[model samples]
Target chain A: MRIRSTLTFVVAAVAALGIVTPAAHADSTPTVRELLDKCDNGTDSCVFHPSSRTEFGGARHQVGRNANNCSTVNQNESIAWSDTTGGSNSIGITITAEYKFGEEFSVAVSATYEHTWTWSHTVTRTDTLTTPPWSVGQIFHAPQMQRVTGTYELHFGKKFYGHYYWYVNNFSATGPEDTDDAVTFFTRAMTGDERNRCPKSVSTAKEFVSTESTPAQPALVASVRPGD
Target chain B: MRRTVATLIALVAGLAICTPATASAAPATHCTLRLETGVVTCGARLAAVTNNDVIIGRVFDDQNYGGSSFTITGSHPCKNGNGRDFGVQLAKYGWANRISSLQAWGNCWLNLYSGPNYNGDHDGEFKADTPYVGPLMDKRTQSIGFD
Candidate 1:
């Protein structure tokens, strides 16, 4: 049935400002650390923007690992991870809080993106409305996918593009092909609770300065560069 | 001829991998789980779902969505386009909502996606014959078997 219970964007973001009880809202895992230091995983850190785990409604997915093979993608898919000790072959993604704008670290992140040949567009844009946001977010998500309804509170995070060869990536947006086999099979990861769902991320080092009242249509919001 | 033989081999292999050969099955029992089609807020999670002690191989009327009914057709495995099987959960069907975890005559597989029910949408096919392996809730009463 349509389980309309779970938290969404603005609600999740507002939760972040209150007493951080990630344990309750978080999907059965330790997420506090994920919010504080997202880069702990280094350059290979991950972000699953469009996930099969339907945490939203109706056939809502369970909080833990979705160890099911996706017929659509023709690959073994999973967004959850194991809690065991030794290093795992699996790669995991987590959503965390966003903070710290344009600092030395931000400069470093920006510089890293520059080195990656894929990134071409300027960080700042003139307009700012929103686009139709046609990604996996649109494909399988049960309820309608709102590109820029001003509901989502994305912090510093972006999508995890490359393999686990590094920690979290410099950029954070992704597409279907952006993922690799190593990460496609990852498990055992933790992102904080509803309060701090927007974990700090290095996706966009600088605040995307909008020129004026006329914002970039959500469609103009280009996706992030894949790898570091 | 060759293709049919290959299919047979694959089917047997999948069963061996999914279930224990010597394991005692609970004897083809039929069960159903129900959930509310409402919003989950302020503590009201999954309402309740009870099992109606039915036997194996015998299909029953799936009354999951309050009233709308559908006969359980069959069950199968979760496979890629190429046909290699993986760790997947089985899916069964009733009427509006899909039925899963079917076991009769040692034959079972998950039914993929059907468009929508009265209230919700049936996602897609899941792995078949996979064990639920949920927590063990002891039955309150003991029973004597008929000779």
Candidate 2:
């Protein structure tokens, strides 16, 4: 009896103070803020690129093959940072559009060599295309290992009540962002004669892509409001 | 006794070398739809495939086109250039980011992306048989746009 009287007095006092306390229900509707918070906890219907809770630091590697003799070397080196969030997005907006990443960066022809025999002697030529941020005079010798650091970004999206919410979280990291090995060669340069004596032409290819691109749950829901 | 042991070792090594290796698994549920006859063929192999048929592309679960595979066929043949395009929603078919290798057909250029709706990290165009989709794109393919 005494505890009940105290509870009633407290309720009366709270009501007199004009503070409206939300009533608790077994099946209460979550607000927009609550839904967004669920995305942060990675427990709701949200999709994360790379992963919802992990750091990506893997590198993409390519190794040049051995040449027989009088060979040509051609290669395409590329590193791309893209979003992999997918689901039934009813809001008609792209998940990637909502979550931005670095970009699709590629080196069309990173290295090239040509060996031609005119009438008199064999003609040999080699060239390496260096784009911005790449140190000039960096050559990728034969039988060399070329590696490009992976890029990282955080992108996520969620669908709630026929609407969608997405965020990039303002967090991104490039393989070379804080490392000296943005693009590095593991082996030493081959001599001109050795390069010319390569057994066969060497062509190498490189690529970068998402580590994980699946959502934990589907992002589709009915169009009903909370209490309706 | 030593000679017998050596012969047994050699026999075991020869068996290991001559035994046929198991091929990688391909997607078992995916099928091919022939646009001309509307015939659906499941577990169709694209090896030695000709260009006369209306083919969209083939996605592999393993690199070098090994393992399980699936073919995509559309209503009409893919255009020579980029006239009309067919975008495969990989997630709808439960194939998002599961492709390690791919090949284009029907004179179409297979364009890969890491995201849905063809957004993010476009992996250029591939008209040749790509045994491996490079270090970056391997297993990162989410969608393929044929044009």
Give the alpha carbon lDDT tens digit for every residue of A40-123 in model 2. Answer: 243212322111011233333332332221211222233222211122121223233223211211110011101110111111
- Cα miss at A209, model 1 (Å)? 50
The global Cα lDDT (0 to 1) of model 2 is: 0.35
Using lDDT as the measure, which candidate wins?
Answer: 2
lDDT score of residue A16 within candidate 2: 7
Q: Estimate candidate 1's alpha-carbon lDDT, on a 0 to 1 scale.
A: 0.20
Interface RMSD of 1: 21.3
Q: Which lDDT tens digits does candidate 1 get at residues B25-141?
A: 322222222111111111111111112111111111111111111111112111123332211122212112223212121111222222321112322222211112111211110
* Chain A TM value for model 2: 0.19
What does candidate 2 score on TM? 0.30
Going through the candidates in order, their DockQ values are 0.02, 0.01
Cα-based TM-score, every candidate: 0.13, 0.30
